[model samples]
Target: MNPYEIKELSPTGVLAEMGVEQGDLLLSINGRSVVDELDIRFLGGEEEILVEIQKPDGEIWELEIEKESDEPLGLHCDGGTLGIRRCRNNCVFCFIDQMPPGMRDTLYIKDDDERLSFLQGNYVTLTNLSEALKRRIVDYHIMPINISIHTTDPELRCKMLGNRFAGSILEDLAFFSEHHIQMNGQIVMCPGYNDGEALKKTLEDVMAFYPWLQSLSVVPVGLSSYREGLPALYPVDAQKAAETLDIIREAQDKMLAQYGVRFVFPSDEFFLLAGQDLPGEDYYGDFSQLENGVGMMTDFKAGLRDALAGRTPKSKGSHRFGIITGVLAKGFMEACAGAIEKVYPGADIGVLPIKNNHFGPSITVSGLVTGGDIVAQIPKENEIETYFIPENMVRYGTEDFLDDMTLGALSQALGAEVAIVPVRGDALAEAVAQRLIGG
Candidate 1:
């Protein structure tokens, strides 16, 4: 095994106080070989540890150290973060498969790394998890690992994932539960395959592992337009969305009665598709699955209401502003803007719904909306002073869109200042209020 090279040390940390410097290599902690951050985190949790390090002059030092259990040693090792494990399965509903060619190469990566699931809340299918990795997870006591469990039927799961080894999903889940590992789950519901009776059966089977499997989110399969040679998967239409919601509701009712907490939830897309109203805040129960689009609309609405309630109406001004969103959220966004206008009637906020020309019309989420589509769809004669876009439109930590369109380029093309706002309703209200009040 490769020794982790120490790149830096925190000045006040125990390692630095003990004369451990940069350029030294960490060999092991408490006789367990250190591989990545996870290893450091797990093994370094003890109040006392024997850390073995190799010096630059080839001197091996065995340091007996005692510190607070939660105190970090502060060794920034090279490649300390867990390396990504690429996905091995070819699921029929894989979004990467439906992506059009000639975009960023990183967008095509299919990551099924359990480490990512633990650290970043990414859902991973356990198909690629080796026995050693499983043991490591259990040994490390990694809790709340998110899983992508499409179904509980072994044969059906294998077929959906296109991997024969995928049949062990239930077994893997059972092992984690038996070890008292907390986990969250997801189901990408595809019509005609894992909907209706299949979905009901899957929910019932997984409910057996309740509390350990804390919550499950059922999201409709996202079908992009570029599926030319891929499997002929059906998108969840109005009828199908309703049916799926019904199944989820039944499971939730049972879970509420037995476990006193709703264990399953359907994404907001299902309610929108089925023409049903979003449930109030009580139904979401802390919004654990908010990242998965569960209760997003409800949360946004609640936040907006709270924000609006806290603020005094601004003086009337003629500040013409624009809000950009995907076609699916156009009406909802319009209503939000209208509510703001009621309090601050001076600002004229127009909601523009951009069609997903790049990913096809069926793909109608604001996060997937490209800057190219925004530029193409906006009317040239519009006199909007500033355009507000949800931060999700741009890639994380950068202003570039998925199509490589930089925020500066978009502003230049549109000939208007574009501001990226957080997806929360309060952020939108604050942005509009700030501009309206000339703050």
Candidate 2:
């Protein structure tokens, strides 16, 4: 059934000004039943439109609208029109494998849809791409797409994706490259599985595509609490982390020297795990992969410095606050908190590292830190007036965390006012400044 029944409509153009009112259901647009907003956007911009409207009283109305190229119909639709696509692959290191059940239903959904990849920058493995879907990507010209290309080796890629169809990633990449379609790639580095020589080979293979491939992100694999039957997956220890860093650093240096660009970046987790400082800001040219945890630390530190620069000290008594983060980011967060405190004296901004009891110790990225894990670590009786959660935890415009717990519920349980800091450096510093200024 069509999810939209426009109650009121005002399209004052060459066509008649007619209203559908509150009891009307939007059946079809230009003879096609709209499945999603994408359909509406795709179909509604034509020179003439035929809308099939259905009344709640079981009557159907055919309304035709003729407008110039620039006119828009004031239409309304249900927010839940878009359906979530579930993932099919059974990869052992999937963070979703570790999630504790019995939360919101949406939390359990494992999405691998390219539509989301195009719309929200979510990464999609090409394993699920049908020929028709591939054609649509080319037809729609979904440029600047993000893909999960953990490895390029056919056999290893098949093993990594746990699907036979996954082995053709190179072919898919070739298709995109041939079409001049820009894309960013992600590798969820599993320690024994794909880290050492495998990672190097994968980088070499993908970087071969050059400018067609925009950037590559190498993030440490996350393990949640729900992995009982999955294959063995281990976290990268300090030694392995250092070795990975060394190998990647050399590769990055060579890439910079040869291509005039650092084609690959290991996420902030690697630097923190290896006890190495983040790369200089200039190393992250344009920060295209920041959302994937690349250059995030550098961006955060720079943001804090600018936000607190030339700022006034706390007006009166102490106002304590805490920012929760994953274990890998503990040191960086502490240093930034200290810097902020230095600028504004008498403000105790503590950096609290929330251990991953939900996803296991292997997962150390901040984006996967659940509310339950955070609530478990942070003390209730602390003098801190408010707790800051990373905005990355929640879907934009929604209170739901990736794990399905609402931020409000977590805040209530913890007895603290929680504010989600925007994922950017500037927004994060501004969040701190606002709290300091009592805003």
Candidate 3:
């Protein structure tokens, strides 16, 4: 059994009280070998635990700890947080496989780790699960795991995922369902593959799990322009998007009548592509799949309405700012800008739609828009004093775009201060209000 090295210990934690210090190796918890933080969390949750630690000077310490069941041990371990398991299956519609070369190395990592699914809400295919891992999950009671269930048909799943063992997806789903494990599911709908009857079958099959399986999100496959030698795949066109929504609506009606809740939902992209108005907030039932682009537009619009209602109309001399977004969200951003302008009469907000040249024009989400495209596409004659870019445009925890362009570089090129605004409508409203009031 491999031991995890204790990187840092909380000053007031149980470990600190037990004389455990930094650089000590955490050997085991209650006789079970500690694999990662998850193991520590699951096994160390008991009211009484036997913790084994090894010192750098070859001293082994066995510390018996007694604490409240809900109290955390509060010790940070090195390389124990993200023991990320790499993906095994080569799915035909994998977005990472379609990424352009020579970008950030982390962009290409294919993670199908269930640990990530539980920790970060990343959807994982069950193709990589071993019996030991399954036992760990069941024993640990890792509730509410997100699963990428593209299809339920055994043969079809194997073909789509390019994994011979992928046919066991239904069995995996059954295993979790039988064990009373709570889960959320995702289906990446490929145009001609799983869009029609296959999607219906998948939905029907998964619906058997009901409240335990919970909600499922059906998002269209993202096809990038870099798929040269890869399998030929078609984008979900306007017609197909409409057809897919019809199928989902039919399933939703059935599920609502049977279960009092719509168990399945189509993403916002489907509605945008189908040229249909977004559904109201009541349809989303807590916006569980907001990160998956389901009901995002409706939620944003609702938030903006509430935010605008709370603000007092103010006129601080005429101040202009640009709202930078991707081509697909141009109209949406324009509408948002119009609402902000109404609240702050002195604010002139122009919506600038930057074409996604780096990942090809087909990829239209604002989150995927590269900084290189923004610098190249912004009009040279633009007189905007500042630009409000969505926080998603930059990588998490940093102000750098996918193309490695720094926010400072963008500000310098455009001759304007760039402000990173959160994706929420209230945040945008607050940002513009502060800027207007300050100037």
Candidate 4:
């Protein structure tokens, strides 16, 4: 069976009640073909739905279900598609191209599919958008499609994306705007290239569409060590990051005055690298550009602080814990550890900062920290009774790090039980409370 094949069902559950069993292929829901996981959610969000199943014996079975509109049919299918569409463009700053050999095959695959943007929150360039595909997107009424629009200058965009046809970013965005498509945009600002004047122009051009452009996130380009033979792109240094934030602040003030919202935001890395303080939580309304690392640390800290309010921290006995994070977020993590220790006056917590040895130091973010780096850095001298690592470091819904190192391997190397802590503040507090206070 293929990766997308339905391989199992929850015992004594919805699928079983409908006579659907393991090995049966999910053909469609409500008579629409199930192309990807997005199709499942879009089609299954109906009170009454018809589902078609293909049995192992080549027979088709049609079943009707009655349930709440948003209820799901319990079926364990493939987490990812085996035959997923690949990206067509070879953009100059493409991260995958900068990766050295000897990694998992999946890491090398570049995907620019729009369905992924709607389903998985992955950004799409819209370079592959055809008239027919555009109509399909509009017909489906996909909301807040995340797009990578480096710049509004079509010719420069073409040069950046390394495709002549890539220059049509604005043309496609205009189409989405005419359709009132809500979109979040990302700009990987390159020095001497898209920043400063070009950025100002791009922001103005995008703001012309008003609310249709939900938010635009300006992020500095990450320069990896493996960028041999690639374009000579310099890293966004302290001065450059500071300058970019200045540009963003000016534009942000103008946008907020005109639209009552900070229509543009720089990613957290900029403020951190520039040695400038991040904006307070209120600046990021609902954090529309959060996934792009814009205002993430601010939101996370605020959430954690709120979660910690009046929540008693208790130390049942003498306990020591190590919380692992990347070098950049070490300060924040140490502060969080201090807050946790406030409740448990007897408990000792150490914030373990791991340098990004796998990726270059420029790529200093907790989410990018590999399991090997943590294992290499977490010293036995810390006497860490237990280790706490962010859930994001591991793959989504799995205990595997980006460099293909599993949590089991990390635990074995560190000689300590690993606790995969949730990124959410409340969930983290609850988990810690259970582990430390209740223990």
Candidate 5:
């Protein structure tokens, strides 16, 4: 890896005061080579620092600065990322493997880099971790690294990830724990493979890590119908969901009695597929696994209630608004629509559940719903001036949908304004009030 050169500089940053310029190559901080963003962030946290920069004219410059420990160095790199380390393991349940050819190139890149885990909340299967990298992570106190430890049993993990070296998940967890590094974990439960007894063993083993393992999310293996010749994996059926839910519930009771926090949580899909009502907010402390869909409904509904408190949108135009969502979130979206509906009784509101034809029905999450499928499946009768679509349906931090279709194109095709609603209570409430109620 090359040294991270300064690609850009904040005009008001400490670096600017130190005469660092754009195109200056960042060589080191306090004799440590500046390789990635993590290095700069970790080393730059010191109260005293030596920054070495190589200018475009091939001149070396050294500058020393004394400042507050937590003060930023005020440098911006491309995405604040060092470099992406692509995933090497061909896991049995790898979602990327199930994707059909000829999609956006970004969708195909599988990243298992720990740097991304610390930066972007992306999970990494410790299979690619080097001893040097591990040391760096521990030394830097990279708190709360998201790890993908599908199973604890060494042999089973190896089989699951299809990499012989993948069996050291427990050892890796032990290392992180020993260094007092906090970690969250994920398990993509592939029904027959990791479910039943295997699931029990994994859970028990993971819980043994205690406060170090912070939390573990158990989500079902999502298999899109595009898998033509991939290995056959069973979807989490009602019985399977119930069985998994039972295990989690039993585990939760024990966890509550011990640590008072349910360390393990099943994804929302499991509860919905099992036809069981989701637990209350108390079951999900801090809502740590909202992205995992653990307490998403609870949090969203709770947020909606909070958003609807006190202020009523007195501006009453009978504006009909529709919410576009996936099958799983239809009910919650309806509830959101209802909140606005109560304000304007005759406001035409509709809930549109767009089936994911791009990845197929098995992929039922809104995030997987493509622009083409949504454009095709949207009911013509469900007409509304503005459609509130979950921001998850579009790419992260971009307007581009999964099918490479921009929100502008979708809006143009539908001839209606599409408002992107974020996956947060306050944002959703604000969007609705501002868009539909014109507040």
Candidate 6:
């Protein structure tokens, strides 16, 4: 029996539902020990499964249940292969490099795993891909790979990824295109590195492989306080953002005209930096790459509006909540705060823009915000009963922020109850409603 073993009391014929329960530790399936989700997924569905289980309270349970074809076993687990694949490339624009020290170790550890890409929609650079793994992806028929193609220029890509193997993006992309692998692409535009004419060239190169290339997202390179000693990477200013947008808009038009699709879209950050309005939801055809910051703003607005309409339009009591956000989202926060106020009259809602002190003023995204930034930003003596913080700012099971401050310490320092709201727009109003009613 393996250390992590679980039994299948009710077999649904699906790999996940083969017998593991809520508190069971999966030991093995058939004769093979379960190493990771990838291995399990690689193992494929079994007609007859030999499952072993270990209960939480020092008990072992084993059961062999046979079921019908393609039945899904209902089970979920957080542990993946027992370790995350940490990143090897130390790119100058890497946001993890900009993190202030002392936060959760998980937050600091960078992952470039394809398993995470398939399971959680996290992006991966094809540079670290081994031949066996590449072959496995083809064999496994893993559709829609999320690739970080920072630049089509091999020399520039090598510089951006900080790995010699990084130059293989075009070759790898060629393989994916040849194999008919559906994939979405990303380009982290640094001011002088891959923007302007360089960006246009990259878009054209990628579009040549369109249709197989589902979508492309161009996001601005993020800077943080930890940027010392890194290559002289520059932030995208308003002028640069506008230029990038213009270039992408032109490419989108061409792609739409010839390919019958707008294959490229600038992220919300670009428009925000340019002080421009977010594109309507219709502009984001299908939103297949929403996780890559493409169509995220549009989706967020739609979700928020839908949630707002579902609201009862009445608050049970007077409640004041302060929503903390980074400078990039000031306009968004203000607009959202306004809507919430209208729904709940006397609902004193304030959008607190926290200067990125931990990552310096250059950092703008909420996910990179540290507890220290929030601690310094939140008004200590404000009459607000609860400080609403977006869940994006902190990692799971850790007190530290993107910089290094603990949530517990921040809560203590502020002398107010802290509520961590998820990034989902639909959940935001529900959380606010809960905080108001003391639920």
Top candidate by TM-score: 3
lDDT values of the candidates?
0.90, 0.78, 0.90, 0.82, 0.84, 0.77
Global CA lDDT of candidate 4, please?
0.82
TM-scores for every predicted model: 0.96, 0.85, 0.96, 0.87, 0.94, 0.83
Candidate 3, residue 59: the lDDT equals 95
Runs off by more than 4 Å, candidate 3: 80-82, 310-312
Clashing pairs in 5: 320-348
Lowest lDDT 10-residue stretch of candidate 6: 1-10
Q: What lDDT score is found at residue 82 in candidate 2?
A: 59
Q: In model 2, which residue pairs have backbone atoms overlapping below 3 Å?
A: 5-24, 5-25, 7-21, 7-22, 98-224, 98-225, 98-226, 223-359, 224-359
Can you write out model 3's per-residue Cα lDDT over 88-145, one digit (the tens) per residue? 9999999999999999899999999988888889999989899999988999999889
- The TM-score of candidate 6 is 0.83
Q: lDDT by residue for model 4 over 341-435, one digit each (tens)? A: 78767668888888887878777778889987887777655577788888889889999998899998888888888889877666656666767
Whole-structure CA lDDT of model 6: 0.77
Using lDDT as the measure, what is the rank order of every candidate, best first? 1, 3, 5, 4, 2, 6
lDDT per residue (tens digit) for residues 334-410 in model 2: 88777777766767888888777776776676777888777777768777788888877777788877666798898
Q: Number of clashes in every candidate structure?
A: 0, 9, 0, 1, 1, 15
The TM-score, computed over Cα atoms with residue i paired to residue i, of candidate 2 is: 0.85
Candidate 5, 404: how far from true, in Å?
1.5
Task: Give candidate 4 misplaced runs (Cα > 4 Å).
Answer: 1-82, 311-314
Worst lDDT 10-window in candidate 4: 1-10
- How far residue 105's Cα lies from its native spot in candidate 2, in Å, is 1.9
Clashing pairs in 3: none
